[model samples]
Target: MAFLWDCYDAWQRALAAEFFGREHAGQAVVFHIDDDVAQTIREKHQLPESLAQAVKPHIDLGQRSHAFGTILARAQALESEAQPPRSLPLLAVSVLAASRMSRDAEIQAINYFTPLKRLLYGEGADDNDRKRDALDQSFGQVVELWQQLDRWLRSNKGAFGVSTITPDKFSNRARIGYPLSQALARLADRQKLTQFFSDAEITPGKTYSSAYLLRMLDAWTNHGRKRFSRRFEAALAEREPAFASLIVREAHGWDGKVLDSGGSGHLLRLRLAFNHKRARLFWVAPIATGISGGTLTSGGTEIGFESDLSPYYEGIERLPLTPASIAMPLRVHGRAAAGDPLVAKYSPQEIILFREDPHLGCWVSQDSVEAHEEHLLLVSPEQQAEVRQVLQVATSGFVAVPPPLFAAVLPNGWRLYRNVCFEDPAALSRVSRRHTETAARLRPNPIGRPKLVGGLPVLKELGSHHYLQGGAPDLLLPAAGDGSRRVSVSLGGRTPRTDFRATGYPIPLPQDMLGPGRHEISADDAVLSLTIHERVVDDGLPLGTGTFGSMAEEIDNPAITPLVVLARRNATETAFVNCDGTVWDAITPNVPQWLHRRRVLENAPLYYEIRLEPHDRGWLIERTARHVMAIPGSPTWPKEDAILSAEARTDWAKLILDVTAPPKHVLWPVYVKIARKILNDHSR
Candidate 1:
């Protein structure tokens, strides 16, 4: 895409150079000025005499001064006539004058003229009595002058040669005027001001009405501050500690019977505290085994929580625990909805606290599973006993492993090896060997000249298949063992027609007799071959039949004149024929066979049609045509010719010739009349 764009740019540059000379072509100049300069220019139009006096001292510095003088002269001429001067020249001259001033003077100018500038660009004065008085006192004339200048600038912007200035260039100049931080601060301030007041009321002001003040306060309380706090809370909730605390508080009263327990205790309750370091919500369950040495001990299962629940905690200090709230599924070790026994072992009781994150479900722990050190919470011994008693009662009828029970059941003579790691050193090597052998078995057989298949005397590769339009190719059939048997063929379940006498070596199969369906051949009781033939289906309109009149009717009521004119003009080149049996002369000697057949047999079958349609810009010429077949003979052609009178042919030819080189006056009114007709038809 980049290469294409480069080629296009090069082509454009070459064209420009060829037409306008290389020195002037491809030379684009862009000017950049600060917003302050734009404001100064606008304000100067309100008080041109003062602006001209201020810049007179530095006016003779360069050719720019002469340009400024010319701008002033134009301004005087427009003022005498009570019209505004062109904005582009005034803007350019103002920038030149501002650049010549010292930094201190520029700042002073901004401060001194701000009040008068505000009278023109500031909030509406009519809305407030005090503002209205201020506007009328000293800035009334300035306001009027500024409005006049702005109106003229907007109306004649193209005449001033400033139409090419785009918003992007203005934004770039704004960016270059101030440091990033200062610009951002200004933007933020503007957003706040706009939030509190309508755009018409946005301006620098030392004082605001009590009504406006109250509105600003309300906006800050309900929108600005609340929005900031929510963002801050969301940011805090991303950390592990804060998130863990949120989960503990939210699930304080969650308790339910687990589903699909697989002999493990299926009931559980969430503990109030959270393991902040591990970012886990702890739970309690009854031990699966009896106590040993007066202490209850059982390993716990550990699973990681999936899905980020931080967004739910934002703004709300704590979530409400209810059955209908947070009943989501959990991902056991990041596996959800898998049938593996390890992952599907237990369905933990749902934690109903807040709206569930669709992707993260509840987690459950079963008895006898060792808890990893990193996942274990430092709970007291008494708490563990209490949890065990609660779970034991919950699982009284469930299966339980006795104390000191073996981890795995073994055969009679077998022994267990503790703390031993089993490793397969040649695992990858065995896999590589297996893959190599499998690939060799799947490899394709080498190609050789076609050979005959078994006792049937047919090639193995020449099996039953489908052939398209042109029919199947010739096939050589081998002779029978006795060297006297004949081959017979039938098509589409029909009686056998053609028969070939068999000799010994080979014979060409009859392909012409087979078309579009199953074909069978047999020497005796056994079927020697079968083939299916088919042609590509065409779903388009038939060739040289769809006409302009039909197509125009197809469109919702189209105009008829432009279409008629165009039809008359291009009649000789198109496939359509007049109703009077006068056909268009073929432009080329090699006319398509289908078209020729359509003209002769169908009595001038119409192929191309034209219509005049109402479009957004005006009238449009719409042309429609059917596909043309280029084959030699038309399948539908008849044996006779349809002729028209010589008088009719002469009249059509003259009409066609007149339209071929129609004058603009003749063509335009036809288009207008067509457009009017289309509008009138649609209105009706």
Candidate 2:
């Protein structure tokens, strides 16, 4: 036990280099070995004959008066170079001594110092033969066992939560993986040790060189294994003594069952008090990616990002968004029901939900928010704006837009419904407050004046482009403080609009059905340019021998715009096609539309098509084509991208992806790095 502390003290200093601070001096591994200990190791210690002879030459036995500075110099050698310098001979000394130790120290060195010895053979091993020779002469059979564990971890990167993403071309030089996993992989390589060490005190907070980090990990692990019950109880006393004492008192009850049964995931997944320290470090990438290491700023903390098309984050709408059965848009020939008629009129609601993303934030999938259109619409349209505003706060589950705002929106007379099921009683208390506040924010209410959307009042306003999966939602909006008013619905600018004259306010407000894309409804002069987009699905795709965006006027060159795609019975969406194909998700895009044709037999691009749909994130590929290339001996066809000579033969210059993070967000360096890496590595 006493010698264990000495081992911890010795290596902790040697490995304490600040992350990436190679130029700065680091603390060296100072040995406490006196001449008597050294003399005992050289003569009486039953070490390997080679190690027995080498110990005297490497270890300073003459200096019984003081700890050896030369050994410390060897431990701290990495201050000048990369890769852990040859494992200090004293490390070998300590490890053997600990194993040969009689009482508390017998198994100690294997858990702590064994890693630095194994780290000799990682991704960068230059003089492998010599290192192996040294390892063989010292540790004997244990080296092979450690090497086997190392191999397993490297191959199973995903299982261990290592980042496979090679952002910024750093893979060729520096390896990227979770620091703890890497430390563990370089540690034993211990078999089950990875799970145990996850709770160990060592963290990568920019500290590199596994020597120091591994040593710290070893001490933490050894301490836990040796004296966890006592240490854990003591630690818990200062933090949550009540909970700890309750558990201690209750140890007579469920604790024995949990411990004896070896604990199911039910116990491990519990938050804070109930959870285990053995849980994985799942937040490393999500938080690490948000970090702007080069510079520091106040609001630089990027929680996450994703809503519409930015230069870097284009094609986000095309990402996987599986809405609930209710959230799924109404299919053309499909029969269905509604949650509420007012909500049903708005069923298949093409709501615009902007959640930059739920990836860096919480567990509630961003797609599920779209499923709540029915719930959202349950609030009157005026209140829909305010309720949504409250829902979209940074911590949607915990608190967003504040609980006061929630109370203000949904007020007393609002007949607030308790539909959401919360497991946490603490969060349960805030639900009604958020509901009430959000409802109160809805305009023309009892609390305050109206907040208008179009000519009517609203709590919040959405963007111009909206989305509708199927049925037309009824538009029954109240006029702002006027008895009766003139209302007309226009389909874009080109229209003799359908008009309903003298529509009564807050009553007899006639409803109208609007199509996909921008629909303008005006009363007096206030117009609402609202849009609803397609809820694109590859299955049950709309079929016709017609075109949406590929019409002559909608194509890139109006001169020779033939039908690029046509839908068919049992037709599957693919890049390969014959003649005209149906463009499934065609709507108002940056350009009218772009052809997404590819080689019929080969996975090659049509260059002109690439020029048009550069940022097309699978939205346009819902296209099904009939004619792909060579139109049966038509030699005059343009063979681009799929052909070797295509680049030289085409008039269109190569399209360069202009993917930069939104200019206003200066600190979004992580996302940009991720985007650039994804684009560069993959051809599509």
Candidate 3:
């Protein structure tokens, strides 16, 4: 029973394919009627009594005329083939008998039409065998019709309207050639067939079955009714000649403002002019990066521009704006005056007004500032504030400033300040402080020397001195030394020391002076301070060989001692050393040429001699040293009398001695007194 029903369904589809062409005929034949038409038909007419009784099955109003025409044509064709001499009421009888027979009686009724059956089925033997053969023969005919339709569809590939298929003379073999041909031509001319079944959606080279082909046709027909061609042509008419030519053949749809064109996977958004006289279509996909001035090709024509519009396309997608609600300024200045009014307008709620520069005139927001070609403006202060608030939200937490209108009224220098200010005052303050600190850190140290007392180091308050945190202090000394300078020293009080050396000579100083002492030594001339100390224990060993007597016995020993002596000069220090087998040479007196070099006085007395004690092994030295010196004339004595009167010179000498003396040396106070005396003498 199911097999019979399946055969019947196939039979109907085959008939539909034969009549409507394979393109329009779907899997099943269905007749559609408008609701209003159906209602009107029911109310206007009633079926005749005889016809109603003869046709007991429900007759589809929509398919009635097509079915009648098909039956009539089939009967006439059969009669013409038979060429019957007596036109037996055979055609009428066959129709009536077939309609009256029930499903169970269908085989017998077919057998009754023996002559017709024989004509259709060739020849048969027994009655039962003949009936079965006749049914197979009938199904075969339907199958043959299906094959014919498929072949016809394939042969007339040009009817589908693709660019590859050229048009040829068409034969209406399937009776549906006209409508199919017309649909294909319309689809080809409008260039919508390719868009409907894009490469991404359907595979190329694969034969679309009859059912699938029909579906595509249905979609194409429905899309046509949308009038995409008319809309596209209208949009093209509004575009510039260059841009319109590039996409003249492409289908497009206008969504009031933007004219959208291209196929399924790719699309171009053409912003239309308000007057519908011009348009600008931008390339959307594969957004060009770092694109400056270039030309984009569409169809065959190239549309050239000096700036990139990919950002504009992306901005629209990211932040869509309502076309009708965009704010337009009553007046525009600078480059903005020449821009499209519609394009210039933007939603204040989406963008803030940034200051206009010579390069970027009237930009919309911070993001828009990068692409300076776009001109945007805010009409009023209220709108500017609203835009600022909106920009704040859009930029996460940044404060956006609207361009000020009162720039001309502001103070001269203040006009150069940024229109936008950072919201975090503390952050701005910290940045300022950081810059100041960095500048100070990079400044070079002052060029001055340390003031010394009695060949001992003393920290004196100099006017505005920069106290360096790390490294040894600088020392200053007069260039010419007569070696006659004598200054008593308090050795125990914070006296610096040098590390022990094997070859060192230990000064046999009294142990009583080793303790802290308070004493003053006067010097007429400047004296240098030399501090000796043990090498830092962690510095390992000194470089040179040890004493000859000790080196042999302690060649493998890890406990060798080293000593270093630091000599102080003006803003600089030199190191000297003495060890068991090695002694550092005397300090070289080659001063920088920039300094005033002076020669030592001939036969000058030996001012000081430093000595160290030896160890029990005769290699190491005891941690003791002695200092000897002689008094010398003041180094500043020659310049003093010339700069000051005789009486003032005496006073200056006394002041210098007091300042350079021991424990509480008051240099600043004594220097001030001498300066006053010099000024008074000069006045006289």
Candidate 4:
């Protein structure tokens, strides 16, 4: 033993120097426990056998580091003693050493057993029948060994002797042993594993109390928690990370709040667990009372920005009437089979209240208590004073309201009791897919009149942030009867865009510039001397004649303007070409006459003249005569000139032609057709 101690002491010194950057000559650098232990020894009379055996091999009681070194050395010696020359005497010695070095012995036992478990539960071994039997036997041996240790400890410790009693223990002598007995039972339950340092025989002096017992109990609790954690990991092996995380989370009882994404409930509560060898499970709570799985119900008060119940909003005190929120308790009353009345309600103690901000609109009592009452207590208070205080608080400050209004405002109020279940992963996957599909169907597409002769539909595209497709190629436009006139189309409701293209025709180049802001179209006709620039005047007032704001349909203020208009000016000799390639000379008086002819060709008949008086409706033109002809199909342009001397006054046929150029701008619909034909025909 002496040799072993020296070896361990030397190894510890070396490790400390190498690991802690400390030299042997440093001032008081080594660890020491005597300052505390010596005082404890003086107060307790004789040193505990545990302390003596644990420290006997060390020369320096002043250094905790040296004492621990002795303990490690003795452990090594015990392991060696277990060899071929092992004897019952050596076993007794080992037992004594272990009782003194309780903490170290526990650690060594775990290390020794782990490898054995791995070998016996060999990986990929095909014999399932044998594996099952081996596991049962191994588990049994562990339990038996654990029991033996418990018994040995109980016999040695003299039971955590101390002088003071704690609040947790106020009972007399017969009940003095209750806590110890209860701890022992818990340790032996197999379902639970605990580390305790107490014995039935140990007792403090006659005046000793429960405070000391409480301190020991706290130590044992923490020790058990750590011990169980390691054992659990060893038993489960590689399958432990996720399950361990889950256990720690559950042990701490953390919770999360979920808001509406469109389902039956607006709020959700979740609790999850995973044991790799077992199945993963979760608990869910919807917000609907009597909803089999809801965590809240309609009887509760409403919660929101205006509610005075929650302190969530920054300027909540500024609102006129603050909103209130609640989670009302559910009560069920019915007749039983035995003709007895059945009345029950979920107890407040059984529920968990989770609200970060409690003052305004954040949370409310689901019970039939006052609105201002705090519903934080989950279980009923056993102390009569506490119960009375709760009742008094509920009655004076908070008051309950009608049930229907409660339901209407808080539709997702329900309690998620223990039995609530989670969604199946497979089913949830399908639901998500369906949600995406529905949103797609509601998406808008832009379709228009065929631009080019054989144009195909362009796949409508939208931007990442766009809510709807802007240009659908499938939408049809009002026809230009006989395919001779121009047509116009509008996309005002479902989709919106100021930029557009004719599936195949070219007018507005994909990269061509449009003016700043949100105006759609403008156009001009030189011969007609008409130029219209579509303008929108949108002022922030509620009376703007544009997309969003309006006090009335017809806004007459400075902010309102006509949506579409045609601008024209009488210009000098601007010419237009006939279908037959004719040119004509025109001056001021001829302006009306020339317009008359052009309008006929374009299928736009003028109902009135520019003169202030009502204008004549019917007046077609004779291009050959260079004069007005009031008929639909006048004698085919008199192809040959009349006798020069006889009909010279009206015999003016100089191929009466007008030049035509592609319009700089026209209505999108009208221009798109001309554009399509132009792009398609080689001789345009």
Winning candidate number (TM-score):
2
Worst lDDT run of 10 residues, candidate 2, spans 266-275
Candidate numbers, best lDDT first, in rank order: 1, 2, 3, 4
TM-score between candidate 4 and the true structure: 0.19
lDDT of 2 by residue, 1-684 (tens): 344234333332232221112342232211222223345443543333333334333433234322233434443443323323333333434333322222222223233223333332343666655543444344422232223223332344323222211111211212111111112111111212222322321222323233322333333333223223322223233332222222222212221111101111111111100001221111111111111111111133312212221122222122222223223332111111121110001122222222222232222111122111212222333454555454443123422222232333232222222222222222322443566433222211111111122222111112222334343333333222221334465545556666543211122212244443446654323344544444342332211112344347666755433323222212132232111111122232121121122111121122112212221211122222321111111112222223222332111111111222223233233323433443454445
All candidates: TM-score: 0.15, 0.19, 0.16, 0.19
Span of ten consecutive residues with least summed lDDT in model 3: 441-450
For every model in order, what is the number of clashing pairs? 5, 40, 29, 62
User: Candidate 3, residues 231-342: lDDT per residue as tens digits?
Assistant: 2333333432222322212212211121112211212222211111121111122122232223333235444433321234222221222332233221111111123211
Report the CA-based lDDT of candidate 3 relative to the real structure.
Answer: 0.26
Q: What is the lDDT of residue 404 in candidate 1?
A: 33
Per-residue alpha-carbon lDDT of candidate 1 for residues 206-269, written as tens digits (9 for 90 to 100): 2333332332233233322323222122322332222222222212212222222222222121
**Ranking 2 against 3 by TM-score, winner:** 2
lDDT of 4 by residue, 370-391 (tens): 1111332222223323322332
Candidates' C-alpha lDDT: 0.28, 0.27, 0.26, 0.24
All-Cα superposition RMSD per candidate: 39.4, 25.9, 40.3, 33.2
